[model samples]
Target: MIDALHTHRPRIVVIGGGTGLPVILKNLKNRHVDIAAIVTVADDGGSSGILRNYINVVPPGDIRNVMVALSDLPQLELDLFQYRFKSSDQFFAGHAIGNLIIAALSEKRGGIFDAVQILSKMMKVDGHIYPAANEPLELNAEFSDGTQMSGESEITAAGKLIKRVWVETNDDSHKPEAVQQVVDAIMNADQIVLGPGSLFTSILPNLMIENVGDALKRTTADIVYICNIMTQKGETENFTEADHVRVLNQHLGMNFINTVLVNMKEVPPAYIDHKKWNEVSQPVKHDFAGLRAMGCRVISADFLELKDRGAFHNGQEVADELLNLIGRSPDEE
Candidate 1:
């Protein structure tokens, strides 16, 4: 067994946003690795969209969730932070307490990046959380039919087959940039994890940033993608594991990923409640040969979990796979 005390904490950089990012982080926090999560800022939906439009602040909804995931706060405190105002409450309807706190701090501290840092210290977050970019980004997607749409929500709602997606300023002028810390984290990481989130919206939005993508390509760290178990409607309706990696490679113009963690257990048909799990409604078809052709060291396992009848990753299992990778040298892998 590896001695927890004497061994250096392996530096891990997780790049993605959306619900799945937090699930993995929640599990990883209990382990010894030093984690830094780089979250996408291209969101334009729900409370995040409302807040971003009203204040031009980096959408705090995703960041807030990531913070709570890594926080060592008491259950009651976390509940209070996650509490959302009722729709009947006209002024604060649909706003999470943590979202408001983050937005307020963003204003007081000059940006969301600083707001997250201040909040991290207060919340006793187990790892670093950095927004993919300091400014609000607009996600732009071109459909396989050669038409395009902007905004994360719009791109998904458009529902066409996405040929590719990229990020730009909300105004379509200046290119968004990540802070130095974000770059440094990627460059120095022992392992890099990409998604278990929306392929185009949650994961790629972060990489769409010129510097972040460039850093990912240049980094010597082992790039491991946690492939999602299900296919998302409007985004990845019929995507295979290889298709996911293919799009990622096409976007960055290089196949830098070293490994892929995929689910071996199959999600049962008629098991998913479409009303609740409408976004990602089907199991992702496996393509082992294709993945091998892409030069990925694939680690397939029974990584499925059912919550409220909805399929999700078994976070503990996935984190174990990541930890095992951290233990092995490139030659051994």
Candidate 2:
């Protein structure tokens, strides 16, 4: 970890995947903290899963979204990169331009890490972007009924009650190890943010990596979890705020989460469109007493954003709370 005496800006390492991760990154972009995103590689659906199957590269969907969020590129160029082919187009149908580019670069560079580093420069990304591991990872889960599932999309689509979740290598010869830079970022960070993403698939899959989890446990940095706005059907159905924290602690085998930023705003009745957001079930219930019992410093606020007929985190509000935890002001920049 960087010493307190150093005159550098506060270093923050945010860990997770899904659309939620990008929301946090974009909101913190102009802030004073140095940012490093350790994205999950266990995604196995949509264009990412298709590309992974064809080329054996890490899923680039989350990384691609994160890159656009942090990239300082012109809007037109970014749009070109993000453009997805229509279903009418053969061969290229259902593929995003960025995913294909990342796949090609990964093959040439011999690893996703180096490809992302080179891509980060080309995309003019402001902060660091690190894949959780060097290669593609498969998410494995044990359900409550003693049934097991593999792959992120399958698990979520199965609609099973999750008992546990972890990550494993695709092949027998490989091992799950995050690169040194990821560990260094975790160790040297002032705060490590967990997630506002999927509990089983997005966040825990990354933590399941041996070295990344170890670095988090060993780091001097304060650990914070940006609690989800709503509970999801497959992963966290009817879970209280404390249940989320408990699951994370259980996965790590310790009470490592130091702080939790929770949204206390009540969702207006009939606001959520369940058909539009099929995965999301209901607003996440709070249990402040339960959170306090876990030795967690809880900070609850009106960090809710209701839009497009769905409930979501107000990233800037959550970012402000995160900065406050580290004694940094968001406006200092």
Candidate 3:
């Protein structure tokens, strides 16, 4: 089915981190699309955190996910990259094989971007991947009372309602190569997508990068945001659809987004219960009226695909909806 869609070779730039962006990219792989993933580097937990502390390297988990998503490699190679060493020792526990590969490449190239390029080529990836920043960035969050928490994991666990988030970087040097590649991809892209991940941590972190934000603001591509399926407890608890768009505007500024793709269907009660998700805590109901008030078009559909305890987007469904919204004929070259 996807093989036939690869004819037009549309250029797409998907921005975010964590597991979400890669899921979307996986669905888009080998289709008639040129994918360029711009990933957030603010993670400070587990293997990524350890690597960052010891070696001053960008968190490689997100980059690794992007690589695997776009890889046309054999299943064995993919599994090997995702392998994690299980050990009773705290120091050796939970480090992923892919993270080690990226760390090694960073050492070899003396830079993260070059190492990513080399890995991309080696994997026969269908698209490119860029870290939002070249240098390691520490995420800091200011609370309503002016107290600040440092580090991404700490910020998430701080328990104080976040007032604002920013990157800590004294070095003013920007990675021109990464920035240029992002801008080039954006300028040439048919579509640019954001989210389906943690709004502030995953999506906004990419936008927080100076050059990356500038490229997004200047891009002529049609923008679409895949709204999260559920409100994150610590981060976006009780946030409505309108609230999501509003926060994005607040952080990245107005009109940076054009359309929002929201899930508009029910999840099985059994699945929700099994996943232990509070029914009352589901994604803020799609507020079509409020979304329209924000001057953004809403593309609401039954995008839910229930697996285990969570509701996920059906990849083909999401891809088709995005293509339709952008006016691409399914049969068009």
Candidate 4:
């Protein structure tokens, strides 16, 4: 809870990709805080991957979703943009109109970074949306069994315990880097939020960017990680909330995550439809002691929202708590 009503709008830089990032952004659109979402571009799956393979452009699916979440356009117009073609359509099958539009813009503008900025204005996006990198990068991960694989989808499907993950260009090249705006946004923000997404595939891909990770570590902003409600099957199987944080810190080489927002509400066992929410394995167990020992201030609350027979974060509640954290006391947790 906010100790006092805040008059000034605080700057918040949210970093991650996948479906979960949008939930928080959608709710924050109504709040008083300024938002800058830095989404991962390492995705190599679905329509985005298909488009990337053919066009040689950055995956626009994540950024496209982020655009919709922050867009202030008309519902009808946004709906039209988000419409996906039926697989039976043959020619344009399995592709969303928005993804195609973003890809076309990326080609016209010469890169995904500028393409997103141009699209942001036309979409009337409420906040800044940035791709983690300018190019279509490959996600490479080494498993606990000493096996390695590339591509986001492949890693998860491998069903192997990911030891660590990183990004690279299509060919052997220099390190992947975030645009100046992405780095600057992190450095200037009062708060930085991570996750509510896949642990390794979605969240780690963005942070693995050399410049982005450096900014996260060097930035003085209070970094808060919104812990996922459930462990993912291939990625975070039987993992606790603290285990998630532990991986992030290990990757970054420091205890930079100052706070974590964990869901206290329980999801009924019978309610989960495994077929629908296939990625979900089980409810993420809490480790308040572990988190506290790592110097992270833990805020455990009923942030769960059961939807479509699966557990998810209550975005409004999570956004409200994030707002309350701006310039507030750690002791408040």
Q: Which run of 10 residues does model 2 get worst, by summed lDDT?
A: 1-10
Worst 10 residues of 4 by lDDT: 1-10
- Ranked by TM-score from best down, the candidates are 2, 4, 1, 3
lDDT of 3 by residue, 57-156 (tens): 8889989988998999999999999998898756768899999999999988987888999999998888889887766776777787899887777777
Instruction: In model 3, state the lDDT of residue 16.
Output: 90
Top-lDDT candidate index: 2
Provide the RMSD of all predictions against the true structure, rounded to 1 decimal: 3.0, 1.6, 3.6, 3.0
Write out the backbone clash pairs for model 3. 6-32
Whose lDDT is higher: candidate 2's or candidate 3's? 2
Better model by lDDT: candidate 1 vs candidate 4 = 4
Q: Candidate 1, TM-score vs. the true structure?
A: 0.96
Alpha-carbon lDDT, every model: 0.89, 0.92, 0.79, 0.90
Q: Candidate 4 regions off by >4 Å? A: 1-8, 327-333
Q: Quick one: RMSD of model 3?
A: 3.6
> How would you encode candidate 1's per-residue C-alpha lDDT over 1-333 as one tens digit per residue?
245312677888999999999999998886877899999898888888899999989889999999999999999999999999999999999999998999999999888898899899999999999998878888899998999888887888887999999888877778889999999999998899998899999999999899999999999899999998999989998889999999899899988888999999978877888888779768899999998898999999999998887899999888888888877332221
- Tens-digit lDDT track of model 4 for 228-301: 99999889998888899999999999999999999998889999999999999799988999999899999989
Native-structure RMSD, model 2 = 1.6
Regions of model 3 farther than 4 Å from truth: 1-8, 89-91, 170-178, 273-281, 329-333
